[model samples]
Target: MSIPTGDVPIGATVLALAEGATLTPVWANEIGGFTFRAQRADGTTRYIKYGPHNAEVSMFDEAERLSWANQYLRVPVVVQVGADHTHEWLVTEAIDGASAVDPRWIAEPRTAVTAIGRGLRRLHDALPVSECAWLWDPYSRIAGAEARGLTVPDRLRTPPSDDVLVVCHGDACAPNTLLDDAGNPIAHVDFGALGLGDRWSDIAVASMSTEWNYGPGYEDLLIEAYGVEPDRDRLAYYRDLWNAT
Candidate 1:
């Protein structure tokens, strides 16, 4: 189904009733969904996200997870939730930060990479695993993708030899990391895939994004900031698995 990429119908309903509110969609991704920054007439801003057809489960799960984590993590506040868990939308308080893809970060890749690394480490260190109940395990995702008939690139379909695990952001792409005016990471978004998994799952996937978004010579910096040498074998293994599933 074609993904919706602008002001959500639900968001429109909310704004129409809200005094002097205007909604502007700021970001949209293929597999995920669209995010709208709602500027209320009161000068207050909130964010609303709606997914492509059949993405309600992911959207709703993300909202619930975000709501639970808001107690501890400096994450967005989920203000409103849809009635049904399916065919739904999520609303959150607007966060003050720019995405890593923002022009500022595009020009300052080193600082942006460092911020991502530090932010990720903080998440890994601070979030108490005992309280969370989810598994973003790659093995399950592979099976789900297959069931959905989504083509898993042959390159991304293998199991890794290393299995040291940690709580991961799951989808740690450049766009998910939010930076402040000073280029420090303030918050993270896109938690649909957040869960307990191998540390390599996060490291490999994030480092690999450098190739797609930032070009060469930056992967090493990410590894350095991650405070570990590149695990080439694990990197190759998970990347191929990610592509496939």
Candidate 2:
């Protein structure tokens, strides 16, 4: 779909509240499906995210999930939510870090890859799965996407008959990972797709994304950092499915 533009109501409100607040756009693109930035005022900065869409199942739900995950995981904490005729917005406290795709990180692929891998492992190991209230099972996700007219890759439309479910960052692209100045991953973002699913569901997509976002030969580094051999079949399958969606 075309990217939405013009002033977003929710974003405008946050910017107004921080009346004299210094604000800089961090991400404003099509894929993220929202606009966000760092708002600084009085030496403190808050990460503000908002979209010019109805605060319905997707954006609002994600806002709730991210807010809740902060109580348990090292993710951003939502500070506010509001909606208007043109949009819905969620503001959150900013974490101290930069996107893993930053030039500093690009200059140190090994460090970036290692940090991402380790962080992924930590998330997979630490998130309290038994209690999370959502389920992003691939089968269900595929069905939902299809119902919404989102094309699904044939391979992913049918659920694999034999994979145990675990909590996964449904969209585990490298950019979603944030790193500290020291190159350590401090937190993750975009929990809209968080759910119970196969470990490979995440690993597969994340591994392939390394190549897409960072370039050649980095997939192995990410896999190594995650402490697993690459599952070529799963990676190929899921990567294709991800591209289709």
Candidate 3:
């Protein structure tokens, strides 16, 4: 059922690797990976993600994490996962809705930002910390950086006291959250970095990302929607760690 190969980018490579699929490029990430959408004979839509051989992030890892997380939350359901000699790819059923950073939401930062906070709380609470098998704590993250020949800046070496421990999203940028037209969160995407860590690890970067994606001032709105006072110390510390690591 493979579609006739054409001039498509990674679509051709992933299609060749995973039989019975014709895909069209849908999204490309900062890392040299591509996401494609495909229409199968059963009339279902699937998304395929391909990470270049040398890319730092692992698509296979993301797939495995998605599979594990699916037990507790609404993450993509894995359809197939495979790797050729040089590239790794995973295919999953597409989750509905658009990213929170979509243009329409960008114009309405209040709604988008608030939804992100509420959704993040839901994710943090939904996943039980006792059952989580992975860690993204400062110790592990620092060690990971050292192995890559990178040094954590002195300031980021120490994290502020944990406000509370909950399962973090690992990479909690605004775009990672999917929202329906009504500005309600449907599902979250991009689990490449999913792991257990200080909730602030996700909150800090998520707040910081508001500035990067929507400009300043919405960070506090997110905090309010989360139903907690801002932990300034943790926010500052994790934002530094985010850039350092």
Q: Pick the TM-score winner.
A: 3
In angstroms, give how far residue 240 of model 2 lies from its true place.
2.0
Task: State the displacement of the C-alpha of residue 119, model 2, in Å, after optimal TM-score superposition.
Answer: 0.6
- lDDT score, residue 245, model 3? 79
Top-down lDDT ranking: 3, 2, 1
lDDT: which candidate is best? 3
Which portions of model 3 show Cα errors greater than 4 Å? 1-8, 17-22, 54-56
TM-score of each: 0.85, 0.87, 0.90
lDDT of 2 at 129: 81
lDDT of each: 0.72, 0.73, 0.81
- Model 3 residue 194 distance off true place after TM-score fit, in angstroms: 1.6
Q: Please, what are the lDDT tens digits per residue for candidate 1 over residues 1-245?
A: 12245444544444543335676667666655566777876778888776554522366778777877777688888787664433356788888898877777888899988888777777777677777787767677776777878777655555664466677778887778899999888899877777777778787777778767777878778778878887888888777766665
Which of 2 and 3 is ahead in TM-score?
A: 3
Candidate 2 — which pairs collide?
166-197
TM-score of 3: 0.90
TM-score of model number 1 = 0.85
Residue 152, model 2: Cα distance from true site in angstroms = 2.5
Model 3: how large is the Cα RMSD against the reference?
4.2
